[model samples]
Structures are given as structure tokens and as C-alpha cells.
Target: SMICMNHLKVGHYINFGLARGLGSIAYATTAFSLGLLVDKINPSLLVLFFVVGMVLLLVDLYTIEEIAINSDAKTDTHISVFKFIKTYRFYFVILLGFGITFGASAMLSTYLINIVKSLGGTTSFYGIAVFAMAASELPFMAITHTLLKHFKSEQLFVVAGIMYLVRNLLICLAPNLPILILGMLSQGASYGLFTATITYYVSDHIDRKHEMMGQTMISMMSTGLGSFMGNVMGGLLQDCFGLSIMLIAGLIMTLIGSLILVVFSLKQLKTHAS
Candidate 1:
């Protein structure tokens, strides 16, 4: 088992992340279904079901971690949470990305679920819709991999960011479920491309010793900090400005992300030419 773990490729991290996208889709699908179910189910039964699901999830994670330790021959570092914060400013930016992306995405979630539900989706249908999202990744990922062979990764990152900027702006006022799904689908390119490209870039340019740390840096941005910022900002903005404004606010942030990437990317291109 330990030998198999050591045989894993570096790019497995990206694939591992992709695999978790389905988990997210399923989690959100169940949550939305449960939300819709609250009106239909007895309150006590609903609460009992919720508690059982959470407990099972915790148990599952614990079991998995035990297996990981056994198979991977690694131990947890008992580092203080605050020490991670004290590490660097880029990590803070990573955190900011997590918070903003999650916050904004959450604001859109209710709207998205409602849109799908409106478009003849039942609870079971919601699961299918979520599955569709999870499934869309494979094709887009293949195209991204092909593009990587022909283009500088920074350029592709900027391209993905641009597509997201356009997709979300239009999504804010999407007139139907089809359009909403189209916008949501941009995540396939936006998050997917930026992440895969960043991972490859870091692994290719950095020394083998630091590659893992560089990926950890990306994980901090994409999941750790990005999730916090996205969820929080989405909630606050939705509370303050309503759904339309909340969507627009998020659209603006993605646009800014694109702009920042463009600026840095152009500089890199110029440096390479010289």
C-alpha cells in the first residue's frame, strides 16, 4: 500500500481535485433537495435525518483518514492554525479567493436550484442536474489539456478567466434555466483551467522538492481561503443588495480576477520574449 502511494504521479493532485467536484455536486444536490423537502416532511424526521447524515459523514472521513495513514505512511502535523496565517501574504490572497468564490457561488446556488426546479426538476431531477454538472468536466478538461500543449499556461489562464467574466455577467440576468446552466457551466473552464494550469506551471518551473509546497499554496487559494471569501461575501452581498445585485457583485470580482491575471500574464509574456 505504501509502495502504491509512492508511485502516484504529481498530476494526481489535480485529478483528485476533479474527482471531488462530484462530491460537491452531490452534497449541494442533497442539501437543496432537503431544503425542498422541509416543506413536505415532518419537522422531527427532517432533523433526525440531517443529524444522521452529518454523523455518517464525520465517521466516513475518520475512516478514510485512517486508511490514508495506513497506506501512505504519513502523520498529521499538529501545527497551530494561526501559524498558517502568519506564513505569508500570497496565502492571504489565496484565502481571499476562496472566500469570494464560495460566497458568490452560494448566492447563485439558491437561484440555480430554483431555476432547475422551475424548469421541471423534481428532487430526483435535481440530482440529475448536479450529475450533469459533474459530467461536463471531462470534455472541457480534455480540451484544456490540448490547449496546454499549444499555448503558454498563463495565457490560457487569462483566457479561462475572460470566459468566466463574460459567462457570469450574462448569467446574472439569465432568462431561463438553460441559460443559467450555461453560465454555471463556465466553471468548467474558469476554475478548471486556472487550477490545472497553475499546478502544471508550478510543477514544471519549480524544483521537485518545492512542487508539493507550491501545490499546497494553490490548494490554500482554491479551497481554504477561496471557500471562506466566496461564501461570506455571497451571504453579505445577498443580504445587502438582493439576488440580482449579488450576482453582479460576484461577476465584478471575477472580472477583477481576470484583469489581474491579464496584467501579470502580459508581463510574463514580455519577459519571455526578451
Candidate 2:
């Protein structure tokens, strides 16, 4: 993310969102293809593909020009993590909101097959649903740059939060395979928008020298930590109470997270204005 921000400098969000959307498409395609290939061919083939992909990525990384900063530029890199967090407490609060909401969304994604099975969907349908979710992201992500022209990143975050809530609500109420797949399509508005804006928001708010830390914090909180919580809690809830209860719990978390984003985002805007 920091690399993209550094290289692009302008229109970073557009390129970032495009890359992320393309990545999702690649994920869906690779996962589905691998599932089929494993059934027909040796599973060991996966390792070869993984190694090839890594090599290609390494080569690609070498092609990008590195942006150099002035030696005398002011930097906060010397600060302790604790001190940094204390200084950027407001941004941390926003990150918390993202973590909670994305956690709920991640839970849905992680357990999508289970949800599909409950609705009598086959693994093929699961693959189709995944594709739908991934493909749906492209158009929304493509338009995010235009959206940014009319709205602040904080404002976009609130909208994304609302979309996350709605997406979860649809999933919770979905009674059939088609409805469940439809709910997955909401990824366009929810995850797509959020991903498009989040790195941009962090980059804009923090010093350029701290961009790497800010981006890392986002990944840790929203994807690493949040996804871990969601996956674990989702499994436990589904095992203990059942799918309905699990969905309800996710929905509740999404609601709380959305409310947090909305309230705090408005406060943030007001502070900036004053």
C-alpha cells in the first residue's frame, strides 16, 4: 500500500482500488481453479504455482522506481509505538471502527461455504458466489476516484460502514442460495469502497515518513487481528448456537461498528472544520 502511495503520489486511491479489485478477481479464479485441479491432478502442483507466482512478484517489485526522501526531512520514525498511538489516538479510533466492521464482513466471507451449504448450495455454487462478490467490486472500485472528488474520506468511511451493515443484514436474512449470493454482491459497496479509501485516508493524515507504519497498522488491525477474531468467533458461534445465531452476532457487531464510524467520523469532520 505504501509503495503504491509513494509511486502514484496522485490518484493513489484509484490505482490501489484497481489493484485490490483485480487481486480479488485473481483470488476467486485461482481458488476455484485450484479446487478443480486438485480433484483431477496432483495437489503438489499448487506448490509449483506458488513458487512461480512469488518469483514473478519479486521481479515485478524490482521494476518499480523507489521514491527517495530528503535526508533532513522531519520524521516520526524514532517515536515508540506506544507514543505514536497516543499521538494519533483519533486515527486509532477510526481503525478500531474499521476492524470491528471488517471483522464481521470477514466472518461472512470465511464461512460463506457453510452459509451456502445451509441454503442447499453445492461447492460449484459457492465458487459462483465468490466470483460474483469479487467481480462486483470492480465497478465500484473503479468509480471510487470519482466519489472521492465529491466526498471526504471520512464521509466515504461512514457510507462504507452503512453498506457493511446492510450487507450483513442481507446475509442474515437470506433464505436461499440466490438470496445469499445476492447478499455477497454487496461487497462492491462495502469492502470495495472501504479498501479504496482506507489507505488514502491513512496516507493523507500521517506524515509521509510514517506511511509504512500507518499502512502496517491498518493491515494488522483490520485484516490480521480483525480477521482472526471473526473467524474464531464465527466458528464457535456456529458450532454452539447455529448459523442463525452466528449471523445475528455478526450483524450486531456490524451495527455497532457502523455507529462508531458514523459518530466519530462526524466529530472528525467538525474538528477539522473548526
Candidate 3:
């Protein structure tokens, strides 16, 4: 995705968001089908499925042409991680917001079974909920490029933040399975939009030479560190305090992230205007 976004000349119509949307559809299908398969068959079948998937992925990878970097360009110069961080401190702050919001949102997905049980739902409902959440991402992600025509990426981040805030808040207060499912559906605008915009955001702001680094940094922050923190903290909070307290904590973190994005984005808009 980083390589395609930064290097490939695939034309204006082909974008990271479109690719991500298609991936979401595939994920939704897999999650729903895998749950049914495991319940009806032996769990060990998962290994076979994974092996097949790996083989298919390898075949797909083999078809991709390697992007050549120009040696004469400054793209060859190696920038230290510390140097990259120092130079792009402001962007790093935005990335911090991404990390926090993504973590909070991810906590819900990680502990979704617990949430379903609390609402008197079965494991089947959990599978359905997962399908709903992932499938909902597709439409919003598909139209992200269209949205970009009218709004800046920073502005869309704010919108996505608001969606996260609403989604978490709904989950926190939901009293029934239907309401919970509705909250899950809100992922279309939150995670879906955020994921679609992030690569473009980093590519636009960072230098070409550091584009891959920027993408990696965002992935590390959001998927790696952020997800780890969310899972650990959410579990601790749920065990010690209760599910409600943990959810409220997630909401607060999301709010902070949204505010950070809003404040910094406004500053960026002002700077650009001036």
C-alpha cells in the first residue's frame, strides 16, 4: 500500500482507499465464513485455510512489479529514525492522535465478544457484528476520494474522529444488541474513513524520500503500539472496574485524539493560508 501510494503511477482513479475498501469486503466475508466453518468443522482446519491464503498471497505478490528508485535523487540518503522524528515532530503529533483514536476504536473490536455477551447475544451474533462492522467500512472507504474533492484530509480526519467519538459513546451506552450493532455500523465513517485518508495524509506531508518511513511510523503507532496499549488497558480496566468504566475510558481517549487533530489541523490550515 505504501509503495503504491507513493511510487506507482496507477492513475487518479486507483487509490489506497479503493484498495482498502476491497480488502474490508474480503475481510468481512472471511470473518463471517470462518466462524461458521470452525463451528461446523474442526478448528484445525484453520491451518489449512491459512496455508491456502499464504500461497495465494505469494502468487499475488509475485505479480507486482518492483518500483525502481532514482539513484541520482536524494531518495538514496538514509535518514536516521531519530532525525525523521525530530524533523517531522508536528506530523508526529498528528500521528499520536491517530494512535490514540485507533487504539480506543480497536479496543471495542478486540473485546466485542464480551460486549455481545453482556447484551445477551450469542457467539453467532458476534460473528454477524464483526461482519457488519467490516462490511460497513466498504461504502465509506470507496467514496473517500470523492469526499477528498470537497474536504481537506485534515478536515476528514476530524470527521472520522467525530464518528469514532459517536461510535464509542453509543457502544458505551448501548442497552441492547440492536443498539450495539448500530454502533458497530458507525465504523464506516470512523475507521473506514480514517484508514483511507491516513496514507494520503502522510504521503502529502512527508518528503518523497521518507514516504515509506512515514507510512511505517503510522502503522507502528496505530496497529502495533496503539493496539497493544488498547488491549492491555481495556482488559485491565474491565477486570478491575467493569466494562462501563473501560468503555468510558476509551471514549475519553478518543475525544482527546479528536481535539488534538482539530487544534493542529486548524493551525495547519492557518499556516497554509498565511
Q: After superposition, how far is residue 99 of candidate 3 from its true place, in Å?
A: 0.7
Q: Summarize candidate 2's per-residue lDDT along 8-34 as a digit string, tens digits.
A: 664333367778778888887888889
In model 2, which residue pairs have backbone atoms overlapping below 3 Å? Answer: none
Q: Give the runs in model 1 whose Cα sits over 4 Å from its true position.
A: 1-103, 114-129
Whole-model lDDT per candidate: 0.57, 0.83, 0.83
Off by over 4 Å in 3: 10-13, 69-72
Candidate order by decreasing TM-score: 3, 2, 1
The clash count for each model shown is 17, 0, 0
Worst 10 residues of 2 by lDDT: 6-15
Per-residue lDDT tens digits for candidate 1, residues 99-196, read: 44444554455455554555555666555555555455544554554677799876875676576676566567677666766776676666656655
How large an RMSD does model 1 have? 6.5
Tell me the TM-score of each prediction against the true structure: 0.63, 0.92, 0.93
| Cα error, candidate 2, residue 117 (Å) | 1.1
lDDT of 2 at 231: 90
- For model 1 the local lDDT of residue 79 reads 37
RMSD of each: 6.5, 2.1, 1.9
